[model samples]
Target: MKSEVALLQYSDASLKPPLSPLFIHNDPSSNIEDHPSLSNLNITQQQEQVQQFLKDDWLPITESRNGNAYYAAFHILNSNIGFQLLMLPPAFLTLGWAWASVCLLSAFVWQLYTIFLLVKLHESVPGIRHSRYLFLAITAFGKRLGKVATLFPVIYLSGGTCVMLIITGGGTMKLLFNTLCENKFNAHSLSGAQWFLVFTCVAILIAQLPNLNSMAAISFIGAVTAISYCTLFWTLSVKKGKASGLSYTTSLSKDHSAVAKITDILNAIGTIVLAFRGHNVLLEIQGTLPSNLKETSKETMRRGVTISYILIAMCIFPLAIIGFWAYGNQIHGGLLTAFPLFHRHQITKFSMGAIYVLIIIHCLSSYQVYAMLVFDNLEIKYTSIKNKRCPRLMRTCFRVLFGGLTLFIAVTFPFLPSLSTLLGGMTLVPITYAYPCFMWLAINKPCAKGVVWWFNFALGCLGLLLAALLVVAAVRTLAITGLKANFFKP
Candidate 1:
């Protein structure tokens, strides 16, 4: 098979001018003989060097590539907006509205900075252009260390996230069933494990939909559902606050000990970090951009990041403030769960039901977004088919098996909140915060005394520290509560 550079060379002859002229040597007018690097090479060696340079500098231009800014924005929105958004209310309960907002904004800026670093690194390093996270790691850190850094985190994040999605989807399905059935079918009648199996089957079907671009419609709907449910949640929480006559308060509870408060605040920070953790798949989304269009990739990334931040700020702050004002310490895992008081109202029940449906849909769609990453990696590693698409039968069988594995894991460990926090600290912190900064530092080699270099270095250290603390906090919480091994337990 020809290298991507070779393919681009072929296409360049037929379509547009070569991308080499745009990136090669950063001096188009300078003769190859004038450049010290190429001047020493013979003609054949010089030609090969130029080809290698082009391959390193730009992603291959494909005629079939069709994504634009809107699709890219929706892709980010779908990936970022998941069941965790609903957990913002509980996060706010721990941190209070003021501190929660501050943390949320800080996380947003931190994520944006890291994302910019990753994109700039991709552009700056010729060898890593259009590469996945793993390849980027290998290019920067060498094979052994790169595989160690990339494989474990990517698997842990993608695979663990898929399992969490199953748990959340199953739990939400159970809630909807109980509500609609009027308690006729309680937790005993249909177990959460069984519902997980059911959703896993559903995801198995969705997983066979081919590729990421094919799921754009589902992603668009998922984004809309996320926005709608977040709006409805904020509205209901505000209504509850008005009825309860409690003002939005930023004060921490005096009843809790200082240690407990600090732990809760750290847990809240972990949850927020998890909510913002979609950087793992940014490169995949970036790949969808038309490779020939100059700056389109960067612009698409900017638009997507802007849209995500705006939506997060709009949804999270209001829900946090109102939900905390109304429920205080009573708030639990999700804002939706904090609606028991309003359940008596028909409108509230209807809204909750709709929100549950939306959550289920969001989970299903977002599951594919992450699961695809895992599938792609696995297929490349295990399958005989390389360069060409995997056969339909092989794809279906692989997905079915993968789905079963995820289902088993979800049933075995059904603790969504704790699992999410663990994944955030262990997988997401590195992927979102540390790795990009480290990669930028390695690839760009910014000035030692420059602000950018020190800023990223500080952020990397902070990310490591934050991950360690959050992991410790999550483990401690689990130990104190004792692990619930019974899958049938309500």
Candidate 2:
């Protein structure tokens, strides 16, 4: 590759002439000897050497090849928007959700910092392979600490898959059971034998999900739906306020009346934290983009982050305050249930249906990405004959299993809130707060001078504290309540 690069540069005459002028025309033998024009070429070569040295030494090497910017941007938007959807409803309601969001957002900021740090660290160490810097901690601690250390990645991958399956099967079933069966209590009342069959099918199906790239491409359309839904909320809120000829207080959820101010604060804090989980998607996005267009990757991520925050702040804050005040705490997942109250008198039922369908699709796309990431982490691969990537029999079996499994969960255990809470508390919390801080510490980045480093140190400490708190909360909830939740005080 290096030789090819040099050859490509040599081909550019505009860049520099390789042959000396004295050796031109008839004297071929003179070409083998040093000529006066060769001195100029020598000078150019020296300058080029200096420039190359600086570029190679000081900068992170970007790929020479480039691809379409639009496609790259679309890729980023798709994955990130899924994180955004995963964040929204949780951000408006749950206490822990706010913490989760903050952890995620912090992780995103840290990811950007890590890229810069990795480059700076690489530049600081001379004559070192980039992989040495990249994986030194992994090699030192991971390879040498014991056979136990080798299990971390395997554990992470396996745990990830399990979390994904649990959430999808649980969330989908919850949505289906509530929407179709209209059963509130005893939602998962299947017999023991029936439960066994249900889980077996779900396990097989979730084990055979798609890759990150495919999910990102498909999610772009769903993100547009999310944007539209936000628009619908804003337009309808104002119209409803005008029609009622009442104050903003009237539009708030009424069930929240009996709740204490501290609970509201806690809930808001949790919601804010959960809203920040958009960071995790950025890591995968950064790697996926063509390495040649480094600047565009940064800009694409920045735009996505900025847009996500602005959209959520505008759409969710008022929605939460209004939904909680008007309907009270009875609002089940803000996007699904809370919207109708704000525009109950204005939009037709058909319009509501359109919004519902859009939300479901958006949710499914986001859920699929989460599941895919989890499965991929597990090193699970499934092939499709349409792409001739996997064997035909396996692909057919995989699809049939997944579909049947989803349907089983849909029929048996349809409880979205509990599933989200459990999954968010267990997997999302650790992935966001615990892992980033641990990874940072693992890298052993020497603390720099002054207040900036101290601030980061403090932030890392806070993340650890929050992570510990979440673990305790999750454990307590599981012990006392089992898997069932009573989010409503009643």
Candidate 3:
């Protein structure tokens, strides 16, 4: 116990975890020395078990733990930045300037604080690593309740993000096909469902690249595309200057009814909440880094997040703030769709085509990072039940099937703008904001109603209540939009 306390004191502050009861005891399977009463045969068996445990990483997200902070940043950017970055402008238009700015900045700070908490909790146990979010929740809330609470939410949060990616990526491809081959493309062009399949095919091909670490190069390109498109779109918008009749007055789907207006605001908040996601996979990225007595992986992840977030700030704020200024309420769908019409005389086919291509590439890379957790979770169960490594080809088949399902959902829906925000409100708010805070409280057990405890409690409660309202708002919005649109249209 003294040694454990000393180790706790020695850990880096950013990685420091409150000493939990779980960390005080050694795993019976791994700590053979603690069981002095074991027979010689039993001792030999325990030794073999330890060897097997060490031979196969308890978590198989990576083949090895040799990744650096740079690779970690790419994973962060790939998952964090996407088509949603473009939505910030519309969210601002929906909420108005002052309220929207405050929400964005506050949400950013709040989620960053929570992510730091997640980083600390990753390796809270001295000889154990909570390399998966579900395991971390189980450790905090105990297995039964934790699984019930977190299992489906994590899958829906992560998987739903992939579904959105498929929608956006496929739509962008269709746009590019139409724009680049404007004269002859419509005759031979595929339907929105077919385009979604094309994107899913690319994603499944990328998923076959073995482990999370193997996607580093693709993540790099994805991250670059994120920055490139953000810069190009915002810069072009600025060059075109502000529109002649720019107004920042917010509206709710052309309805002025009190209920409609309130629902629109709630959905906008959901959009912002969804934008800050990627914390679900935070520990997984850190798991790829080697940890030892002298140093910890949390600090490495902290560095990576700091750098990636700085770049994220660069991309999102300029694009969103300037985009809102340039287009105001005219911003619909995204800057991409609104841009060509708003600046048709000044804009070229090359500019619109370039943005579409970048968006498609970004979606392909981003899908893998978000879907990586889904793949790992599936593998975790397979290995546990089979008591061996999962066969590679079998794993590949599972990914293809998962991709197909999300594609089906993406193509079946008419692709309303409200859907992603609806999903964000339903699943992401708790997974990103509320659950982590509660898990920290469960593990840390800070003084009741004191500063630390109260702070987290307030945030968790806020997330829950906010999610409830957002759901009401999102459902209302979806019903209104669905009534006006056809099924199976993008």
Candidate 4:
């Protein structure tokens, strides 16, 4: 058994393709006999072990049976781009443009590299090529470490994201109601908790949709709204800054203490981490590509990541720069909230209303992108249903129950930004950055002195440290501000 595990590890190292855009159609299994450690094993026995391994870890999806590149791209965009972009401006406010840009760029590159690591690891593991993130962890780190390090983070991150979506969706709804019905209904009367419940019902309805592929149109709409609101927010920020003559300098305020500044910087890092928190779903999206071609999955992920990076570059940088420039220390939790309400022109009011509407649409659609993952994980554990067919009654009950639980959490702690910071800082590190690198090191066992080995090791360590610090900072911030009142408070 030990020898068999070692052989699997050797195959992973020997078979992984170099990082490149071009795909080579070579099978790694053909070279297993070349390993010196496995010389004593007969070819028939070796083949049998490999076959058994494949059977034991069979993935529901396969390379030969997957969706196309376009669908995959849309899925990636939907998963990556969401309400998180709204926080980028505030992150910029914390770190200033120079450091903020550096963090953003570094995060973009690092996330892409970690994603490639996950892809290569998936390719190296036979019978688990189309497996989910949790399976990949089990394949690399064993069941114990997999459960502790990978499974928990993936589950928490997915479920926590759903909670955040509920808060954001409800908050946006409340904002829209106040702005649109300024004269009729009192926004203060309709508590945030109520709005959250309203949005939870909407999410449960949408969550009833069948599968990930069924959400392609929804994802596409989400992607569009994400880009649109980000663009609009930046435009408004720039206009507001110019009218008010706000400074664009990267100077710290005289009133802020050193500790406060440090806290702010950590908060910004946490928010940026959250903004790039889509690596958890990369494999699921990749599974959507057509499996007929040997290079389809690789090419699909590459194209999708490339498009997402392009969108992020266009949206995040400007929003961060202009938002900070406009509001500086005065900036609120979100850029849209910083916009002045009183004495606004009718066109401005209409545009703001439109942006809020887009936010609602975006959040509702994006909610399913994450909720589907939670549902899949839950159904796998609880339901006896097989082959993607659960009884309609069972499925409905699960969705409502899960949705209700998330709604309850959101109502209890309706502090959107603080919760987002905590969730990102607490879970994203392992899910997005650390686990992929650790899995690669475990499976490949690259030369200890080699650059690649040290690079991954460093990234894994850095991710853990960063996550810890961000969690501390976020918790401190939450304690200082106190939780939002459950219902409504003036």
Candidate 5:
């Protein structure tokens, strides 16, 4: 614990967070290498010496992090958008177009600011890098509390995300086959379970491609498919023109009364929040870049974030507007499922099938991005307990187990995706919206009652309030809907 404290930079004694070692000092502008204590060493020696201070060299994210800005941007794009965009249109209708647009843009801007906070704080400790959320959490809170607080959310998020992807990807693949071969292949059609197995098989293969940074090609494909499908969905909807009749009303379970509408709106905020999924993995994304005082990884991270989110905005804003205009409260699910694909006058079956292909591909890469944190945790735990490095065979087995477990859960509980959305309302909000603000205050405690201190305090409180409201709304929804799901229905 003392050695770990020695490795990291610290805040002033007056503002230090509750880490194990109580030593504290103000963080200087330059990195540890530039600190006077280490100025005697040669440049190469200093760089290598700084490397000696990182606590978790055994972690997977720390292995061969040779990725550049473009790769980081690609992974960010892959993580941020997916089938979640499909649900955003409904949020628009529920919030009403004007209010919905405001919420959507506001969430985007808010998340963007929070992610920047995470990036800046990644190397707040000079020679050390937070690299992973667990490390960052521990730095902000102390070891025991941080470890307990962070591990569950990260585990559930990674596992739940992978499961939902399998469900959605497999279902999308099944849809494509049904669309393309409606008149044919009836005698030998694969069931939804088989399609899920197929998706899992492909994901397992992608998972074998070593470290997170090494999967740049796969991430690139995921980013492209996400953008492409989003474009196709919105463009096709706009081509269909507005519905014959429309009203400014929202529907959930076909109920649009005052009470139901309010509940529906609360749930819709969850939907929008989940769409911007980058925060769950942003620190790890930064882990793949090189950081030093000369050219910090935050610069690369911010650039990539700017580029990726600009593209995300272009895809999502138009989609939300057009999707709401076309279907209004009538949209029951995704834009693609609002009506039969083959029967649509403006959309050909071929294009619809292509969109499904993109969805499968995007989900495949998304699984890898989210699952990396779980993989790192598993590997690190093994190394810690055994007091030795995790071998290749054991690492391979970990990937297999992760892929298999998510596959089993996804296949057996197709309805988990719906439930998971509500769960995400409770679980994801703190991690995404609240944690960074609290962390910033703890690590860089500005003058009390000063602008920086009060601003962060207010935002943190706001985030907590929003999370509490979402949790209450989710509970009300579950109480109303009841947990009715058939086993192995998919």
Candidate 6:
């Protein structure tokens, strides 16, 4: 018993976590020869020995921080997918799913190609480092084709601003109408209020008159208005008719399988390619970031592509599935219509609003880029003529003129969607995809390259095929829509 007690005491005193001694003695008077194991060494010596053992055997700990980065990345990805789901109708998900997948793949490849070209363009220009010039080139090219690039910004801004106004305006009118119905205010009844709203719209349009650049502004506005109405044609696909939950279902026609398939291809391609339509802005992002941040931003771009493309696929897939299952061929903007049911909360609303704002800003910024390019090109032309930057007064005058033109479109038609479609589908398509592949082809000869070279060649060919398809689709859509009255209708 005494020996056991002594051993227990010895062990309690000598041992410690992480680096514990072998043993210790409780009794100070115990002879060293009495217990060879316990009396051989003091607690200090045992601890030292234990620590040495640990030091020899222990491996370095490696704590990874990339987990959180990956989490954030996936979160962005899911959100993008959610947006795509909201856009896609369910019908295509069932029958036209295959075609949609093809479009998305094509869109992704095109996006990569487009960005590459923009980078190449940057390298091509010597010492001229303004991004806005790219936008100018688009405008210049479009103008040669009889489309006004500078005039586009005005139209896009007007459509968004006016649509928002109408939404707000309709709400205000509804409130007033309800008040009149209840005899709560002196304002007239529903019909009277309706007339008042029409008059108000007219009055607003008239006030915006002096700012008009031409019929171009009005035409753009009307087109957007038409698109807005068409947008409402798509039905919401909330389960139990609930307004907030997962948007996996859609309301689309079960018929018109072939038409839906074709539409799905076009829509999927449009969203994936157009959603990431800020390669111009990427240059700015890269330029502004610090070296480390820039590298991080490059990673961010990769993450973004993966995230957005995946999200687009997720959203569209389920939508195409459910849309076809339910409403079939009648699926319009099946993705967005479903939003009201799934996104009733303020946070969701705010997030969606922010996305819309980002898209709008992206579109508007694109116009600014075009305008700056035009100004730069014009300045060079002016320099050639008179050997100086265009006079400040003249510059200011042009800015005001352009700014006013934008305002006019903002108020007048405020409804055009055709301009963006044409730009994105035809010119932007080739410039972004075809040019990059060719540039890479020119820069990297195939014989010197093995896998990478052939991969690039394949990518270029894919881009060319997509661009050709875009041109054909765009022309076909335009022709079918008719050119007799005003062919620019959305």
Return the TM-score for each candidate structure: 0.82, 0.55, 0.88, 0.81, 0.87, 0.45
Residue 223 in candidate 4 has what lDDT? 84
User: Measured by TM-score, how close is model 5 to the native structure?
Assistant: 0.87
Q: Which of candidates 5 and 6 reaches a greater TM-score?
A: 5
Cα lDDT tens digits for candidate 1, 278-301: 788877776655442234356666
Where does candidate 4 clash, by residue pair?
A: 63-291, 64-291, 67-288, 67-289, 67-290
Where does candidate 1 clash, by residue pair? 56-126
> Which stretches of candidate 5 lie above 4 Å from their native place?
1-58, 248-258, 339-345
List lDDT for all candidates, in order.
0.68, 0.40, 0.76, 0.68, 0.76, 0.37
Cα RMSD (angstroms) for every candidate in the order listed: 6.7, 13.2, 5.7, 7.2, 5.6, 23.8
lDDT of 3 by residue, 12-120 (tens): 1222112111222123343344333222337575454443334235334645567788999999998888787777888998898889888988888888888888988
Greater lDDT among 5 and 6 belongs to: 5
Question: Between the candidate structures 2 and 4, which one is better when assessed by TM-score?
Answer: 4
- Model 6 Cα lDDT, one tens digit per residue, 21-62: 211112233344444443467978644433332221111000
Estimate candidate 4's alpha-carbon lDDT, on a 0 to 1 scale: 0.68
Q: Model 6 clash tally?
A: 40
Q: What's the lDDT for residue 338 in model 2?
A: 52
How would you encode candidate 2's per-residue C-alpha lDDT over 1-490 as one tens digit per residue?
1101111122112311111001001112223123332334676774443333222121111111122334334433433433223334333344433443464465456534543333333212222222221133332245344224323433332333333444443443444434444455565655333433454454444334344444444556656765666556545654554323322222224555443333443334344444434334334433333321113244544454455545545554554444333433344555455556546556676676666555545545454443443333222222111211344455446455544554444444434334443345444444444444444444445566446555556655665555455545544545655764332110
Please give the TM-score that candidate 1 achieves against the real structure: 0.82
Q: Highest TM-score, which number?
A: 3
lDDT value, candidate 3, whole model? 0.76
Of the pair 2 and 3, which is ahead by TM-score? Answer: 3
On residues 1-490, what C-alpha lDDT tens digit does candidate 4 reach at each position? 0111223333332221211111112233445654444455798966644543332122222212336666666767777777777667677766777788899888878887898887666556432353467767766787567767776678777787888888888988888887788647683457778888888998899888767777778888888888898888777666544435445554457798987778878887878877777778777676655432234356666776777768867887787767676676666666666664411552465787899899898888878878877776655543222423356677688889999999877876666555767777767876887878888999889998699999989999998888889888888888887866544321
- Candidate 1 error regions (>4 Å): 1-64, 126-128, 185-189, 243-261, 293-296, 346-348, 382-388, 487-490
Give the Cα RMSD of candidate 4: 7.2
Candidate 5 local lDDT, residue 12: 21
